[model samples]
Target: MASGLDDVIAAETTLSDVDGANGILVIRGRSLDDLARTARYEDVLALLLGNFLGKETPLIQSELGVARAAVFTHLAAVDATILALTPIEALRALMARLADGEDKAVALQLIAAPAVFTAGLLRLRQGLQPVAPDAGLGHAADMLRMLTGETPNVAQVRALDTYLVTVSDHGLNASTFAARVVASTRAGLTSAVLAALGALKGPLHGGAPGPVLDMLDAIGEGDNAEAWLGAELAGGGRLMGFGHRIYRVRDPRADALKAALAELKLAGQTPGERLALAEATEVAALKLLRLKKPDRRLETNVEFYTALLLEALGLPREAFTCVFAAGRVGGWVAHAREQIDHGRLIRPQSRYIGPAAA
Candidate 1:
């Protein structure tokens, strides 16, 4: 067996391709460079869902609007009992109410639930009642409006939209594999999505971005960056954002998000001092990483810039992975459908290495 399923081809998908060696990402026949600059979250969702819906898929922008409102109705269940847990847990508890099924309507709910549920949980945390979703707003903009209970700043909306589109889908990574495994068992889309969320909750996966902020907060200023990063490396601590598991070169998503943050800076949405500090820290960390471990390919990854952009968008650090779920849910639903219609049950054989023939 391939340890950790390394270099394994799990499934055939027209959804997205992750070229780790070349540091490129392609989603549904479009390069990430092409999509990140212009596509809205709804556009990527339509592209992903269209794999199965084909000509039958109506204007998903409005349909997703309806789906957001439908998922909002469930916020009533997010009472103090559920709120007692962490953000992702509370969101998961609320989301579990979505009835398990594989229909197009069910798929839409899975796609839309993350944004609505995340916004509701955030509002309720601040002693505010959940805001209703606007069926007229785009997914990323509406999500921001609901989170803050106000109109979204246009530049910030573009930043968040790029974030959602950038992360919409990738090849079968851990969470996607978990999703597909459940789908192969004929679990409904909701079930598969929940499995993916569970996998993402782990720190090694979707949990990394929040800590990027924690690292920045710990550093606090540009002056302390080199010392902080140096100490981190000396003590064998991994710099959270400087390295990626894939992409020996720079992560393409990092450039995409950094450019988005630049837009926020250009619009004066995020403070310039904050951007300068982050840039300094990134430079210092990269230098330290190369000096300390010359053999390893430790370059800037997506999580580094993700923390900065989402913070500028005003999302709390704790809800970082929930925002991730909001984007990745599109891929989960599409892959689940793909597995259901086109693939067999996923059952891999083991080598029986443990206490064989006892």
Candidate 2:
């Protein structure tokens, strides 16, 4: 048995190819850079859905808007129980209310759930009324509007679009694997998505990005980056955003999101010093990591820049993973469809070692 399933090939997928050694991620036939730099969130979602929905891009975009509106009705369903949870927790609670199905509408609703529920929960927690979905606006734009109750600038929309596109899919990650596993069991899209969300809630997966901001906040203003980072390393604490499981080199998504922050900064009036401090801290963390683990490649990963980029886009750190789910839902849907349509139940045999199975 391969411990932790290292180099395991459990399934074959034509969805996204992750070339870890080269640090390249290709979704379908397109490079991540091509999609992240040019495509809108709807465009990428449409692309991922592809023949699964058998709808054209414009139609897919239109249906996504309708899906957003459909899921928005559930915002009224939120009660004190939901409000008491964090944004992601509240999102999970609301999503649990959705029915499981394998239809296009079900897939699209799963895609729209995180955005509607997370934003609604955030607003409700702040004593603000939930913003209804605008079918006229794009997914990322509409999401931002719901988040801040203001019209986001072009740059802000573009950055979020880039984020959504960049993360739309990658080869079977932890959450994606969970999604595929549940889907393989014929549990339907909503259940698959819930499974994925459960996996993402773990700290080693989608939960790390929000903590990156905490690290940056504690290290404030570049000057103390070294001492702070040094103390963290000396205490044997794992740096939040420096290393990735798949990419031995720098994560490509890190570059994509870092560039997103740069583009947003160029077009918007943000506090540049915060970006500078984050940059300095990243450099310090990477340098210290190398000194500590000379035999291992501890390079910058997506979480570091994801925090900075989302902060620039006016998102609270607590809502970061939920926003990430808003993007990865497309992938989860695609993978679920693939597993249900082309694959089988995901069950692996374990060697009996404890008391020789009695």
Candidate 3:
């Protein structure tokens, strides 16, 4: 048996396609590059939730924006105190507090919780008051506004939106599966969201990007990247930003985010010398890995560019996974609502593994 049911296809879905072998990612029939470059978060949300709702609801966007703005009103008192908690904890509290009813209000709060929670958590951690959301702004744009207390330029907003949309939905990913499992029990939306957030906080999901930065830092200015990476690999430390479980080739989201980072001019990097050095390091790592492990197809994955893209957006590494939650809230809510519509309790059987027949 493959441990943990590894490589097993557990369920059929309409959510996403992860073609690691070909380095392609298709979400709900759309390429990630197409969405990241062109579609707004709202548009992508509409696409993801389209099948669940049975109709397009323009009001969802505005309603969610207003709700996000309104929730910040309550955080005024504990704004400073909450900062002491980790970002994930702060997000959990905010989501629970804002969850209240079955009307559109609940839905809106669910939609807005990620942005509100993430932005507020970051500012609170910085010993700064949380910035308010601008209801007139798009979801991604307003997120930046709340985070920095300044409206992002068109390019900046676009880049952030692309990042949000790129990670919005993937087929039965660990966290999404956890969310569905929780949702299947008919648990409240906030509960399911918190469960999903907890799943995301793990290194296998949310913690990968920070180590990518650490890898970059350890490499020290790209000059010693090759040698440093070689040493790390030789020492039995896995490279932080390469390879994927599902994608046999490259990760499509990696290239998409990389392009967005380039477009925003936010790589905060000198392209020629530094970029060339990074590229050389990447090439060397790949060559060495290939030569060293010919049986396994280890290659670059989404985490590499995810680290660089979020870094360019000025987000601290600690907040990366929370930001992922911000984009994914839509899909989670939609899936929750969808599961509730069907009303099935998730129950899977497992073979007895401990003290069998005792």
Q: lDDT tens digits, residues 55-138, model 3? A: 354654676678788877756646545667777777776777765433456766777878876887788777788898888778
Clash pairs (backbone) in predicted model 3: 20-247, 20-248, 20-249, 21-248, 21-249
Residues 169-233, candidate 1: write the lDDT tens digits.
88898899999999999879899999999999999999999898889899999999999989988
Report the Cα lDDT for residue 200, model 3.
85
Where does candidate 1 have its weakest 10-residue lDDT segment? 50-59
Ranking by TM-score: 2, 1, 3
Ranking, lDDT, top scorer first: 1, 2, 3
Number of the candidate with higher lDDT, 1 or 3: 1
Comparing candidate 2 with candidate 3, which one achieves the higher TM-score?
Answer: 2
Could you tell me every candidate's TM-score relative to the true structure?
0.97, 0.97, 0.91
Local lDDT at 129 for model 3: 81
Q: Which ten residues in a row have the lowest lDDT in candidate 2?
A: 349-358
Query: Relative to the true structure, how large is the alpha-carbon lDDT of every model?
Result: 0.90, 0.88, 0.75
Tens-place lDDT digits, model 2, residues 151-241: 9889888998999998889888999999999999997899999999988888889999988889888887798999999998899888889
Q: Quick one: how many clashes does candidate 2 have?
A: 0
Residues forming the 10-long window of minimal summed lDDT in candidate 3: 266-275
